[model samples]
Target: MTWLILISASLNALLGLTLLLLWRIERRHAYVRMWGWSWILLSVGLTLGVALAEPGLVGLRYDLQALVASFSLMGSLSLQVAGARDYRGLPRGRGRGLPVFIAMMVVIVALAGIDQRFAVIAGASFLVVGAWLCAWWMGRGGDGGERFVALCFVAIGLVHASGPILDPFSRSPITHTLGLYVQMVLSLGLLLLSVRRAHAEARRQAERFEQLAHVSLQGLAVIQQHKLIYANPAAMTMFGLRDEAHVGRLDLQATIPPELQEEARERHRRVLADPAARIEWEGTRLTTDQRRLYVRSLSSHLPWDDAPAELLVMIDDSSRQKAVDALRRQALHDELTDLPNRNFAVERLRELTGHGAAPFALISADLDRFQLVNETLGHEVGDALLRAIARRLCRQLPPQAMLTRLGEDQFLVLIEETRDRAGAQAVAEQMMALLETPFAVGGTELYVHLSAGIALFPQDAADGPGLLRAADSAMHRAKGRAGAAYIFFDSAMNGATRTRLEIEQALGRAIAAREFLLEYQPKFAAGSRKLVGFEALVRWERPGLGRVPPVDFIPAAERTGQIKALGELILELAARQLRGWLQRFGRLLPVAVNVSPLQFEDAGFSARLLAGLQAQGLPHEAMEIEITETAAIGHLGRVLPQLAHLKSAGVHCALDDFGTGQSSLTMLRQLPIATVKLDRSMIDPLPEAQAAAVVSATCALGRSLGLQIVAEGVETETQARAAEALGCTQLQGYLLGRPLSAEAAGELLAGALSAV
Candidate 1:
């Protein structure tokens, strides 16, 4: 029995030391520590039991030895139960079990002094109960190792129970040896349980990592020693790899573009040097199929299979980059014409005018009568026409020149290396000439005209915006000319534009303040010098500026669309003068009012004019409308109906400035006019052979058509007499009488009537 106890103690000590080493390795599992201490205490109890049975061993009293060994055994049993509870995650009894167990042990020890049998039974009972509790706790939710440990505990408990039954006073050699073997098996099972748990936890973590790598959207690759080792699904797809087999064979150098491979290698070296270093860059990558991919990549040092490796995370940024590029293009380009817009033009201008840039010409071209096309045709056709014009202009541009659509009906051309104003003017002329050929749009042959303005860099203005403004001003000046024209920017045009802007701003206030008046020029019958009628001319007398000439403000008013209001004011003034004359002399001469072509464009012009005459209670025959030949020819379709309407209502219509325009005899025959006024240019050179022949032909044509002929600007008697001989029905000029105010004209009319 003593040898068996010593052998069991040796085995228990060895197992305890092994468990303690494991606990030291993983301190978080405190149950291992507890189990180890329990085994050590059991070993101590067994050794003491041997000493108690052999009295000469330690030279202590039998009862004392027995009591000490019993206490050690009880403490070991308590620890075994506690360790089991902890391993199974069961709660401690909050220290109540400790005091009760201590009291029970004390009682058993006192009784053992009187009867050794009672101590034996009580100690054995304690061992059996504690072992059973451990078995229940460990086997409840335990794995194979823990269950095997619990079975060993049960076997050891039964052996201890048999020792008390068979030999109540002395230790039993057979049962003690059997309990020692079972305890050894239980210790081995505990160690195996710890190892199994660790292995299972490691497997679970690896599985989770694998799942994440497969599902990740970013391409993840591990490279070691310049060779691809591992790649996730995303990485395989990104590089056009077939599977893991393909990735294993792929070289890291092959994935990077040849030009960037050296840089990539340097970056990899840096990343490996510092484990915490993360390098990011944007570059092109080559796929398995030799396709290029734009990628934003991040490279970092990582550990793979216990070796240094590089982790490359590539995000496919190709789509995002393409979207960004497309958005940039849309921002700078016109969608309708697919041409660079004003924004791009401004950017190009800035680039061209930078510090070391060569001189360039900025040509601003505008389509003439574009609004007329938009109004007459549908906007669809207008858009097509603008696109066609843009194509033609683009074709005509020189290779060094860039064309950009500034806005509706306006294109800006930038010609590089332009030397002088003449070079710029040449480009402008070429661009304008392209529009002279008709464009076929929507099955309609459309005749488009262009007005171009050229401004030289560092000559007209220094910078981009200033150059554009100078060119635009020149373009407007060119637009004022008859047909397609190109002009160079001069400093004088800026002053003229400013003055025109000021005049346009003041026109509205001028009309509202009644700062205008009309003067009448008398027209006399050439045969008898009898008063025929008077032509009403509007004059402005600004308060502070005195009189502003009609030539200065009239075109400004028309351009600014203030002509309609000014025309209404003139009509009202004429009606009032006629009313006054009727009240004073009981009669009035027919007053001819010059109407603007813009006014004739209004569909309601005749309605508004006839309504005004009727509101004054004046007869329609008391007024006549005079339109210039240019107005009639330009807006022939629009003017014809309005003129016919007025003529049918007994209001006479006359074509003014006839010989100065390109109106043909056919156009004259088509007009609903009662008279044609020969312009001052035609009348000034009269009585010369060529001029006489021209005048004679005009008069003969007029007589054949049975239309009245009036010669204007008849400054000399010979010219007036020649006009009369050439069949002039009426004459009006400074030669007869200058323009007069309403009162003077009224007095003149009264005298003429009194004489008759």
Candidate 2:
């Protein structure tokens, strides 16, 4: 059927043009456009002979027949080039060599008019080469679809090539008919190849998405009908499973904690029923080993296994998230009392004020004489007392009130949801009663009183810090009164506070300006009144204020950290004086310098002190560190190590204000002190039977503990005699020699050179 050949050519040209228009619209594949052009060439070749019966074309009919064959041959070659360009990403222009091939084909077609058989053989060779190239190019792509495309090219090309080859040898109708069938096969093959490539591309995209899901940190899994269809490594690890099989084996509902499983099941049912529904649930997961782990899971719809599926994402929120919360708490809470610290209190206050909260009260409570507990009993006992106080305060506070430690012996109570000032007073009184009870600290029953200051919202200075300051000023006013009590903030309290702050500021400047000088109080042998070492007393001389009493600044300095720096200055000054004394007297006697507990806690205290002494050519044994009993007990543990270090370094240490502290015999025996400075209170009542008994017992204890007993604050002859009879070895007070300036002290030392 030559008509069939013509029809096939017409159909090929139509298909080519349709595909060309489709490619322009879709731009799906690079090979489609070239394949369309090839089909157009084949249609042109078939059409060449379809109208050959015209008289005008009768002389050129053989030439036209060869031209049709050449066109058909080149069309097949275009298909081969199209395959290469599509599969290998090669350019169609480079691969086809279209214009050169067309020129050569036209020349060959012209020569074919001389010998028709030669043209048939040449065209068949062209078909073979083109078909093989197409097969090879398509083979370079992915498997399955690519293999079929290659096979189609080979089969169609070989079939069409055989027609031209056999036609040259035989002039049979069967041989001519074979080309029509081959053309049909070619058209069908091209459509099949395109279809296969589309399927391959879809499969590749699915693979790429799967790979991306596999590497994700979130536990990703696909579930169809509550059975796992796929699981990534994270998903498997989250479920304590080995593979997809394990994921399917474990029932999700059963894996959740029993109490939470009901909600989880309901959520799952709702999500599965709707398919588009999304749900997030945070719950505990039960491991195979019966351990529970916290996890937050999110489930949403996804197309998996060719159906609507569930994409499950599990995030482990147990250890990591809880650790973050704990760190946040540590930042807010006090390490010792586990109470909210100053920062947390301020933040809470800001929150309350930001919301314009009303009628709340902030009470600043400072424990009165708390330092004595620390200094007498040691820091261990002091910390225990504070923690006990915190617990007690927290227990006693009203429901809406929050208690926070503002460091040291100070605490803040915020009545967040109070009604009026009466409600504030009720909270303050409740806290006061809590402190009224005796607390067992370091094996001793102790009573701590609170001096509380109250500042109300809107009534007092606005804002957190300002309100807290007003409360603090009121607290100071309360302290100035007879007993432990609470006072409301008033306008005049601010003036007192400002004055105190100014004094504190001035003290800071005085130390920096080296405006302090030391006065040495001579110590004597109790019985002989023989000269011994002198105690170094720090005296501050303000420019306009003259000499501010030690009573005014010493306590303030002790509360602030000015004591540490001031102690360093005093120690350095003392070391320099010792060097000068050593040169003057041909000997260096110990000059006792008072050390605050805060100063003793310095990590570099021992090293720095020794270095300063060494730099001044002063002997470490020529100076003694006098620490109050109250200060000593507060930092007992820290002091022990440093004290031992000082003893090893040939430095002297003594307990000052001896009997005032809670520690009596234990510290005397335990600490590496060379002397115990008996508090003036013990000797002030001297010569009385009771006072004598106390002094005798204290001195006996000191002697038994291998400690030197030096009675301080000896202001009378009777006190000195009592101290001597009470077994005191050294005496210090105004009775023997008042605290003297360096020049006066030098003169006294020179006068007492014979006695010394």
Candidate 3:
């Protein structure tokens, strides 16, 4: 019996150490630590019982041995119950059970002092209850390992319960041997349960990872040893693979383009060498079906099957790249002509003028009379004509030159390596010569002309904008010439440009100050020399400048859009003067006011003019609107409607500067006019046979149309007589009367009425 007790103590000690080792490996299993302490306490209790049985062998007090053995047995049972509760995830009830356990230990110690047999029975009762509780807790909803542990505890409780019944006075070898076997079985069951739970958790985690990879949109793949080991659904579709089997057979290097294979190998080496490496790149790849794809991919290191591997995520970027390229082109190129636009020209100029650059020339070209084509033949034909012109210019350009459209009717050319003014001039001339030929547009043979200006680097101006301005100014100067021409920029043009700008600015102030006045030039009958009507002319006198010539300011006013306001002022003064004359003399002579072409483009011009005349309480016939032949012919579509409206309202309309325009016969026939004022050029050469014949033929044409012919610029009596003999009904020049002030004209009108 003593040997059995020693062997059971050793076995319990071994089981306790094994459980403690398992607990150290997995600290989260705190119930294993509690169970290990319970086994250690049971081993000490068995050892104490052996010493109490033979005090001579251990040389210890019998009473002390019996008391410690009783306490150890109770402590071991309490711990078993607590550990069972912990394993079942239930509260240990330490606060309620602690006093009860102390009372049980006190009763057992008191019982041992009376008789050792009573103490042993008391301790065995506690073992029976605690072991039964463990069995019930462990077996409830338990697996195979937990059920086996419950059975072992149940057998242990029965063996200890019968030990006190069978031999209450001595130790039982059979009972101790059975307890050792039960404890060993419990430890094996615990180890089995822990391993099974770990395997189950691992399986659940793997399933979650598989589901996430299958549903991901980004292409995901794993490459090991330069061969495809794993591929998700997205990766298989991206590479045009039929199934997972297809992906498994493919080599990673085979999917890459031949030119990019070396790059891929280098990247793979980097990923394997450093576990934290992440590489991002863009390249082309070949699909399984031999289709090329533009892809952006991210590569990073991944551990797969306990070995280093590469993980790649890819995105198709073909469409996005193409869209970006298309947007860039639209921003820099002209939509209509498909050429580089002004923005592109400016950017190129900036690049060329950076730090140190070779000398280049900028040529500005403007199409002459392009507006006339648009107004006459329709804008469709005009657009066609511009396209034709662009194509011709491109064909004529040298390989080193670039042409860009600077908006409507304007183009810019850049020539590199231009050495001097002559080089620029030659290029401009060559470009201009390409337009001398007629272009067939919309079934019409249209002749086009170009006016070009040349500005050189380090010669005309310094920077891009300055060069552009210089070229534009020179172009305007060339446009002022008689025919198609090209000119180089000079310093004098800048002064002229500045002066024009000053005039434009001052004109705004003059209009506000009302510093403008009207002068009337009297018209007379060719035969009777009788006063007929007057032509009201606008004249400006700045307070400090005294007077600005009409030629200098009129063109500026028209160009700067100041003519509209000036025209309104002239209408108001003329209407007021006519009203004053009618009140004083009880008669009124018609006054002709000149209108600019731009003013007629206003949709409300006729309505505004009629309203003004009516407001002044004057008849419509008291105001005759005069338009130049060039204005009437160039903007015939816009001028014709206004003329027709005024003619219907009983207001007279006359074509001024008639013979200087291109189509005199067309204007006479199409325009609703009451008179035709011959230009000074036609009358200047009058009385000459050829000039006389031309004037005579014009007068006959006018008379046949029931129109009055007024010959202008008749300086001498011979010219006046020649005009009268040539079937002229009216004459207006210095010979008849000079332009007079409002006061002088009013006195002259009163004198004429008194004479009548």
Task: Name the candidate that leads on TM-score.
Answer: 1
Error of 2 at 428 (Å): 0.8
lDDT string for model 1 (121-236, tens) is 88778888889888888887777777888898888789778987777653778777787778888898888887676677678889998899899999988888888889999989
Candidate 2, residues 1-756, lDDT tens digits: the string is 556656666777787786677567547786777787877876675556332322223356555574665666576566656656665776666534767687668766765656655655666666667777877877765477666667766776666566554555323345445545655566566666665666678789989978877887788877777666777887777767866667667776666777886776666567667767888877678765556778888988787657777777888788976897699899899999999998899898887776566768899999899998878889999999999988877786777888899999999888877767888998888887777789987889999898999998878867878888889889988998766899999999898678667778887888889999899999998778878888999998889878877877887787777888888889878887888877898775678988888887788898888888889887779889888888778898888888888989999899999888795577777888888988989889888999899889888988888778998898888888878988999999888889999988887777777554
Q: Clashes in model 2: which pairs?
A: 374-634, 375-629, 375-630, 375-631, 376-630, 378-633, 378-634, 379-633, 379-634
Task: Report clash pairs, candidate 1.
Answer: none
Clashes counted in candidate 3 amount to: 0
Residue range with the least summed lDDT across 10 consecutive positions in model 2 = 49-58
Tell me the TM-score of each prediction against the true structure.
0.69, 0.55, 0.62
Tens digit per residue, CA lDDT, model 3, 114-181: 77678778888888888988999999999777888899889888888877876774366667777778
Error of 1 at 588 (Å): 3.6
Query: Worst ten-residue run, lDDT, model 1?
Result: 51-60
- Candidate 3: which pairs clash? none
lDDT of model number 3: 0.86
In model 1, how many backbone clashes occur?
Answer: 0
Q: Rate the local accuracy (lDDT) of all candidates.
A: 0.86, 0.78, 0.86
